[model samples]
Target: MDVAASPTSGPATPAGPDSAWMLREAEQFIELFYGEGNGQGGPAARMAEIRAEVAGTGTYTHTVDELAFGARVAWRNSNRCIGRLYWRSLWVRDRRDISDAAGIGTESVKHLVEAGGGGRIRPTITVFAPDRPDAPGPHIHNEQLIRYAGYPQPDGTVLGDPRNVGVTELALRRGWRGAGTRFDVLPLVIETARDGIELFELPPEAVLEVELSHPRYPWFAGLGLRWHAVPVISAMNLEIGGIRYPAAPFNGWYMGTEIGARNLGDTDRYDLLPVVAAKMALDTSSNATLWRDRALVELNVAVLHSFDRAGVKITDHHTESNRFITHLEREEEAGRTCPTDWSWIVPPVSGSATLVFHRYYDDADLRPNYLRRECPVEGGPDRT
Candidate 1:
């Protein structure tokens, strides 16, 4: 319900049944959210208690405000969720012709709605729930899309709980890509392999696909990053650890598109999502053999799925490691040298996996060459 301020100056106290009911409602709401078997208290009953307590304190007039605050606290506490979605847009401002940019925010979101190919993004919202069964061709741009993130509150606001980061800052960091005021909205998608918690995007398009492989039997231990076209630069590429990786070809699983126009005449506004795919790397300090001390490589790829200029379909993409491996394999087949003992560090929270580097070659004269020496060096064993 839309919250409204009360006319009375002082707070109003809740009565016997009234106060009890409110508390019950709150508790029930919590139950529906976190799902059953989550070990949380019942929703209907809990709301009653909160109502009675507030009434006893004589702060009933502020019920609306309290309810809003309580709802947020309730959601955060029970859901274990964080983050938000944001949006803004750039348009040529002919101050001489029109002096307002009131509809830009609405328009930006509209584009994503019409595009409509970002998985369950546009269709599953509660607002659009009724129209689902027999709805004719795409009706009123569905506004039901939900956004979530790792952090619930903003930076200045305290997030005493450390499960996630500040929602506002995450939104702003990405929202800056869009011009004008930022809205608190997020995309609804869950990255698997990682916990199936709903993820939030700062006004992302539709589908974001991120993959990080370590080239080993258990391949979940690498750190890689992925990107779709932001609202700025036309084409983009990624360079990490002195290695350059190619963008997904023809937008394979993750398509490509034209970066959006610039804002404030900066010509540098681009939109993209950068996620730190959490994972734990191998711990080798305990052993003394080469296998024990080998450095672990970590790869994380996060795709901030959103919309392209055309607003026709959801974009898809893969992380850099896959692209790098494809290139490395080709080079080896051509008798070119490559690196060895490659390892990745997957964060512990997200689970663990490993990437093994097997093939070794030698070609010191070539640029960007990482060859493994076969014979020992002047003072020690071969260290190519």
Candidate 2:
């Protein structure tokens, strides 16, 4: 059974027998992950070895190549993710041997730095230790490696990202003293079944952030808008076949809406819509005048322009939407059905303006998918 990691404490394990389903999943993953070029021996020999390992008392360790391929395929099978077109490009780091909290924190910085790519953000994933036959795997309590803190002010308004207010409160209760700033990066929380939990402060070099600015409007830089360069999702379960790896973290270059539309413009987030709109001298009298929409477009323009000027890797919704169609066509040629969630695939700001908005997509979980797990928090599963 999968373990639930809480923000307040360590993870809890629910014991379950190793069943035939796990073996079947392992077999499926081995076949799919290895493909034609398996190992030095052969695919048949490798499959036999995997089967023996699964059937035996000791746990099986995936070959280096298997780990890499499995991670890439997991990205490919993520139906809710609109960025699967570049799934094959994922760089996977196999850290299955690491179980200590300190090791995870140290290596996670490497994960961040490598994924940062010195401004050219890369799509990457790191596979940590898997849940063993007797115990649960170590878990990352933070939703992401880098996230802005939310400080609840006396006026009942959050001083930072409002969406993270609850988690920030939990962190404070757990002895995390934030800088009380709008963009304070949260500390790394690692919860283990054996050692309980520990905390690690992120080093300065591990985080690559960009200051937001407009190309023409100099005042936009004065708004003090900025965002982290990479989004390292740290809480998803990487399911290859039937095996679940709870501590695996992955990342990708951010889409423009992820910054401009939702993170900054959302009402509960930074809520910069009214602020940006007023600065642009747009009519704030009513919603019918499209002032909010116009402001949103300009905000997105600043995001794209800033990232571009900084030499970071980012894709616009229109370009990515067209690429999704291209991905579908390629999948069709390969006789594979492409599973997509329309609500997420469409751009948050300009849903009707994008091509992905007008299409119907089949919802399917083919294989080797990354699954969203229910966190210990009460408000359902947390997104990383």
For each candidate in turn, give its C-alpha RMSD to the true structure in angstroms.
26.7, 4.6
Best by lDDT: 2
Write candidate 2's Cα lDDT for 1-384 as tens digits.
Answer: 001110111122223535566666677776765563555755667767767887785456677877777777766656666677777788888899898899999999999999899987888788888887877788886777787778888888988877676667767778989887899887877888888867788988999988899997899999988888888878677766566688887888877887888889888778898998889999889889999899999999999999888898877878877877888788788777777777667778788988889989887766676666666532223322
**Candidate 1 lDDT over residue span 1-384, tens digit each:** 000000001111122324344444444444433342332465455445545755685212212323233222221121101100100111111111111122222332443333234432221110111011122111111011221122333454322112112332333454422122222233322111223222233245432322323333242323322222211110111111111111100011112211111110111211111111113344434455332113221221112222322233332212222333464466468553443222211111111221212333231221111111111111111100
Error of 2 at 281 (Å): 2.0
Worst 10-residue lDDT window for candidate 1 reads 1-10
Provide TM-scores for the models.
0.20, 0.91
Question: Pairs clashing in candidate 2?
Answer: none
Using TM-score, give the best candidate's number: 2
